[model samples]
Target: MPYTGPQSVDRALEMLDAVADAGGPVSAKALARRLECSLSTAYHLLAPLTERGYLVRTAQGYALGPRIPGLQRSLMQHLEPVPRMADVLAGLRRATGAEAYYTAYRGGLITVVDTTAPVTDTGNPFTPGRETRAHATAHGKALLAELPRPVLRRYLAEHGMPRLTRATITCAEVLEAELSRVRGQGFAVSVGEVDPAYTCLAVALPRGREGGRGRDGGAVHALSVSLPTGEFRRRPQEIRAALAQAAAGCG
Candidate 1:
């Protein structure tokens, strides 16, 4: 069989593990010697990893960064607050009579990690692992709005804003302008873009107190509510307020 594992990912983890084993910062020279890689290669990997918050550069050397704990928290399936998060989502659903979704935006993709949708709403299309329509979803827009300028520019360049509806922002300039509004308003709105009848309101939560934002300045997670067009129009401000309030609790 072909060697299928991600080599870079494996190396990065190994570097992190090696540092953890030392119980303190590990210099690049030591890392290169331990990993049996060239000094240049070790430094190369260290630079990007540090930039992305996977590792931090210290006076002694490189050490694991604060963001690692948040990533670990996300992966720990048996963690305690999962039940609380479920309760929060359930409450959001009940309050708006709409589906509540918890989403994470990372690695240039949006992943819907969880949701609380009413059984009666079979037409609900979003689910975990659905491809992100960054130009058309409130969660996507909210997260995208937080991306650093360089990262955001690269993202739009790679994934040109394909229109899903007449309301979708297609031009880079327009999208930037809209993202500015999202940042200013502290939320994002998507109306009939992903689906003709559905509207979504979302708020981006702070990544972690220690890590602040990701290296790219984007939010690590977003919470959103999707509802029918008529209902959204009826109480858009009310829904936005509820989402912002819930997001505060999360932060």
Candidate 2:
């Protein structure tokens, strides 16, 4: 069966994602398969967007159009300021002596909002951006563990747990159990789940005051530190104490 809610709009968005994922203009047939729709449906979905300049059709196929730049600019203008999370990220870095990060969960995406000033000083593994595998990182798990049960379930349904390493929790049931433990412990830990040589610990930060208006506008954020696996294991107590103190001041 085809999508029922705002059928054309949903189909168009799916088509857009398919084209973008293809990394170039894609044939209507390939897009149909990617969208799990018929060739005719794919054309029908793309036609209006193409005409309206949301998409561009070339001899090869369709790509994002010029209008996208304007739209992106408009989006940036409406985004919340970045300053709100800067001070907190700086404080976390000083307290932990490790790469400190502030990540926000919103619209079913985990985005790194701010990182400490010296992100590369101690050889951090990750850069600030949207994370690919939420189930394999301490900060991702911390944010996931804080979500209400229903929302958590919805997120899992939309984005299944994908394995990133031998230690990643690929099963939903197991992940739920792990999140339960995270809740009880008041923090989340990832040991070689994201990187074979790294360990990370994270604690969920409360939404900001003033209705959570910074870095993606009310997106829930977490504080985290990454370390070499050996160092993390050796100084677990000390690192946890620093993380706890930093997390306490997030709001």
Candidate 3:
């Protein structure tokens, strides 16, 4: 089904996506090419976005504007976890000596809402935004495992499973089998799927009256811990135990 809504609004949103995807300043000509529209039409779409502070015109080209951070802050406010969830994540990080993350599936996307500050300079890969590689992420898999088959199919159709690493499951059938295993085992694991250097283990938090519901009436929240692949493999039981404890605390 094609979008039957207003064309201008759809194109404006697409233009913003193009700018974000560029990862740097992008020119109107490049955006026009990406959006499959004329340069003039691109400018028309850019004008409102610029005026609205969603994009900024830089000497190099158009870049994400300051307003983007404000939107993120507002979103975080709404998506903030229960007060104790942060303490729970912090305790999990200390207990397992790994980065702890609290993720939620909302608006058809998985987002890391809260996380313990990186213990090392390596920094955290799971940030607070739309997580693209659901097929290769433990928190993503935990949430995806709870979705109904039809909703899962729609998600895969919209966001094709891209091979981020050699370990990433590119085949949908294989991923479905993996998700089935996650459902049976009550947890999800990502071993070098997103990055060969790291591994993640995650468990879904039980759904409650306060914890939001998903399309399949399953818990939308998940807790995950990430560590170096070697350390993760060496102490898999310890990591899983910490993750389960954190999930229970959050629930």
**lDDT by residue for model 1 over 9-28, one digit each (tens)?**
67777887788667689999
Clashing pairs in 2: none
Q: Judged by lDDT, which candidate is best?
A: 3
* Candidate 2 lDDT over residue span 77-187, tens digit each: 333333455676677677667778877677567777667735445456666666766788999899888776777777788887877789988988888899999989999
Please provide TM-scores, in order, for all candidate models, with all chains considered together: 0.64, 0.63, 0.72
Ranking by TM-score: 3, 1, 2
Candidate 2 Cα errors over 4 Å, as ranges: 1-84, 117-123, 208-218
- Estimate candidate 2's alpha-carbon lDDT, on a 0 to 1 scale: 0.76
Error of 3 at 22 (Å): 11
lDDT of each: 0.77, 0.76, 0.82
Ranking by lDDT: 3, 1, 2
Q: Residue 236 CA error for candidate 2 (Å)? A: 0.9
Number of clashing residue pairs in every model? 0, 0, 0
- Tally clashing residue pairs in candidate 1: 0
Candidate 2 lDDT at 15 equals: 83
